[model samples]
Target chain A: MTTLALPTTEEEIWRYSRIDELDLGAYSPQRCATQVVGDPAILVKSSGSNVLKHDDVFTQTNRDNSEAIVIRVPKSHAGGAVEIIHHFDTSGALYCPRVIIEAAENSEVSVVERFVSADGVKALVIPVLEVHAAQAARVSYLAVNELGATTWMIAHQEAEGERDSNLNLSVVALGGDYARVRTECRLIGQGASAQQVALYFADGTQMHDFRTTQEHVAPRTHSDLLFKGAVAGKSKSVYTGLIKIHPHARGSEAYQTNRNLTLSEGAWAESVPNLDIETNEVKCSHASTVGPIDDDQRFYLESRGIEPATAERLVVLGFFNEVLERLPNKVLATELYDRVVAKLAASETVGSE
Target chain B: MSVLEIRNLRASVAGKEILTGMNLTVRSGEVHAIMGPNGAGKSTFSAVLMGKRGYEVTSGSVELDGVDLLAMPTWQRAVAGLHLVMQYPTEVPGVHVDELIEQAWRTRGRSTTELADAVVAEAERINFDARLVQRAVNVDLSGGEKKRNETMQLALLKPKFAILDELDSGLDVDALRDCARRVEDATNEDSLGAIVVTHYARLLEDLKPDFVHILVKGRIVESGGPELADRLEADGYAAFSG
Candidate 1:
């Protein structure tokens, strides 16, 4: 086995990241395990990740140290939210967990993988998830990151949807010192559709970074990506995404939008959206916006008797309402809304002084 | 005792003077019609009273119930019982009308569920379709529908003072009458003091305003009873021009 060097911010994919701050020598690899809570038949040993290939140093390291967990959803299973809760507690530890989800043809399934950590513990978690949606299948997957304040997470999610399948992917990031998720999705079959929605907020000295790619490889595919975030108290967030339509992917439709809100003077956000369309019959568009909330929107609510502070809180939460509504589960969305409100309330007290 | 007073109001926008020493007083349970031609600063007067930014008040005083309104922030003014029914009601995506009005009552510590029911009942009063309550605030609504939604808020909040700026511009005959009836109903139910700005007397007919002031060049050039509206309707704003 060859020793892989740590990555730096000089690479295009790692630009503007906190890669330099990461010290690989500080952590030793640990074997991770998973326990199935739902149908035992769904849990099986897999040889490797077919969808998520090792593309970066972190992924390669994860592959080198992690034990694999495979979830197999049979045809017509009609599953609910199957949860895989992974908690890290060891300090000065490096833990890698690999997961693969295969939704059989004509099946409908939803999975939620939540990552957590012991409070104030310094640790690193590198997780990789691969999802393969078979023909005519429907899959919904959510990754919720609620790590400890001193912990860091470097994760990758790769998915492929086959002929006429439907894929719904979501991410809700609210905690961590430095967290990053690189999502890559490909529509490899005709008439397939994918919807990606994410809501990430960072407070204190935390940083959240996201990179995504929506690739349409077949004709008449559709994809919509919306990622919204808020940063306060010297925190930062970055969003970079691409919408690519191949030459043979005629009559395809793709849209990518990334919106960020900077709540404090020290808070910062960067948004970059790109499109590469080789077919004239394809429809692709991308938009990115990063700034403070609009004054007019706030004033409009205030004039209607909403207190300025409450009005701002409403706008920030409301900014995520569209994406929240698009979530596969409304109950989960409501819970997330309340969490965001709590974060805003805490920030309110910070600003009052 | 309850009145909205604007005295010697001189204001400007972007260094160009608009309101030149305007003056008016709206008492509770009274409706005032402000008739003016284009460039007469009717909208500017509404904006200034609402404490909208971009309008510099050179010399003026706005008082609500003897409290100096100009001294408070825009939202504090709302909390103090002032509201504006903007001509072009702003659209706030992702904010539902029912939810926003619920938040309105929430700030006042009112029961939001009760206020929500009140919104639906108020919608019925204006013949507004209840389905629209679920839609985002003012988004994709017709001009007249937007006016009706505004009236619903007015009824719900029951502000001590309200200003309707060009709410009758894009309404049809029925819509105009409906808007007028809604305003009249709110005044009867809550004694809502109101300032209605318009360029036509058609809306004033249904309103039967207690007072009519012809504002030209940012000043009240003419003030009279309901008959003033008829007179202006017969002789256009030509007599008040310049």
Candidate 2:
């Protein structure tokens, strides 16, 4: 049997990534239980066949050792949000959690997947999530990453929208020593639309990397993406996104925006946005920014009698508020906001010392 | 009464001297109008007083209530009762005015209930849109709305001294009168000392300054009663220019 080789940073897709530092030999396959909560009919442990593509070695490996779960929203049913929580407690373990969500025609559903690990655990987790929105259906998925400080996560997310369907994908990642997620959204049917929003914050030497693609394959399709992040301490973050319109996808519209704030001299952030159009009569734009907090914003809060550190905390929270406001779930948004605040408060303590 | 005194205040920006030996004194409940031509250090004076970065005060003494105002940080200066109504208030997206003011007030041990009441009261007093306090601070506010928002903040913060830097620059006839009236009421009711900086006589018609000083080449070259504003408005700053 031939050995499978891991990907390297030399590839364009992995540019500026920390994949070279990963050690696959140190980890062994282990099991982490998946707890399904809310709307029991919508989520189940099943042996459902996977329909999404295995684009890379990570997805293929996850499929080989998958703890698969299927979430199906019934036809014409409108239900509240369901949650899937995966808790990892073993040390030096490799765990792969796979999820497949399908919304029937005219159905509406929301799902939140949370990955959490025990403190001080050293492990590697690969999570694969596939979302399929049927004709005229609505699906909203939020993935929250709260892994341990010593854990590493490589996540793959694939979403597809059918005729007249709507899809929303949101990510709030503030955990793991090194976490990377690659999200791809495809609009395959006419009048299908998708919106993706994310808020990621890194501190205390942590790193978060995101790569996203918005592909329009049919006429009159639309997609919008907004991702914002903040880096403090010696932490770092990287975001690269692309908008692609196919040859026959005329009258398509796509917008991508990524903004980052580097809160410390040692922290770093990089944003790269690109657009490709194979057809005319399409509107597409991409914008990205990586910089320190605005001095004017800092002064504005400080002049209002807010202490410098407190002023910074407020500004950072305000920076993330844009994403929070756009979140589809208010309860989840509040929880995500609290996590960001905790991270900022932790970094503030480190800064004052 | 509290006093904000600037003695021989010489300041510079980008290594070039702007305010060369400027002096002024404003007491609580008193109004002082500072008129100057373009580049005569009108805005620089306000910036330096608020401890804004990049504005260097070479050799001068500024005392707020007999304390070394220059020795404190910008926020500390605000806590010590000094505020500048910025000419162009910064646009802070995603932060609401109510949240900002509430945070500022709560940090000083004030209750949120008081802030809520004060926000509504002040907004009404200044004819500001009460709903705007719920929106992002100055994000999409028009020029007139921005000035009104600043005026509302001035009333709520209640600083011991404020420098209205070109408060009338962007206001229409109606907005200018309304803002001037609100400020005048603040001065009379709260004893809020102010330094009204303007180039036109229209705003002074309602502000009614106690002293009008002509600032030329950084220093107050001439000082007189309210009539001085009329003379400068009629004769322009060309009389005092080099």
Q: Which stretches of candidate 1 lie over 4 Å from their true place?
A: A1-4, A33-36, B109-113, B169-173, B230-238
lDDT of 2 by residue, A1-353 (tens): 11467889888678888999988778888887778888877776776645565467788778888878888888998975688899988888999999888898999999889999966888899999998888999999999989887789999999899999999999998888899999989999999999999999988889999999999999999999999998999999999998999998999999999999998999999999988899999999888899988988888888888888878777788899999999988988998888888888888889778
Query: What RMSD value applies to candidate 1?
Result: 2.1
Candidate 2: where are CA atoms >4 Å away?
A1-4, A44-54, B107-109
- Candidate 2 residue-wise lDDT at A103: 90
Write one digit per residue (lDDT tens) for candidate 2, span B115-189.
Answer: 888889888877788999998899999888888999998888888898999999778877778788888888888
Clash numbers, per candidate: 0, 0
What's the distance in Å from true for residue B212, model 2? Answer: 1.6
Every model's TM-score: 0.95, 0.96
**Highest TM-score, which number?**
2
Task: Estimate, for each residue in A1-353, the C-alpha lDDT of model 1 and write its tens digit.
Answer: 22777778887778889999988879987765444455676777765447764477787888788777788888877764477888788889898988888888988878878888867978899999889999988989988888888999999989999999999999999988999999999999999999999999998889999999999999999999999999998999999898988999999999998999999999999998888889899888888899998887887898998888878887887887877888887787898888888878887788677
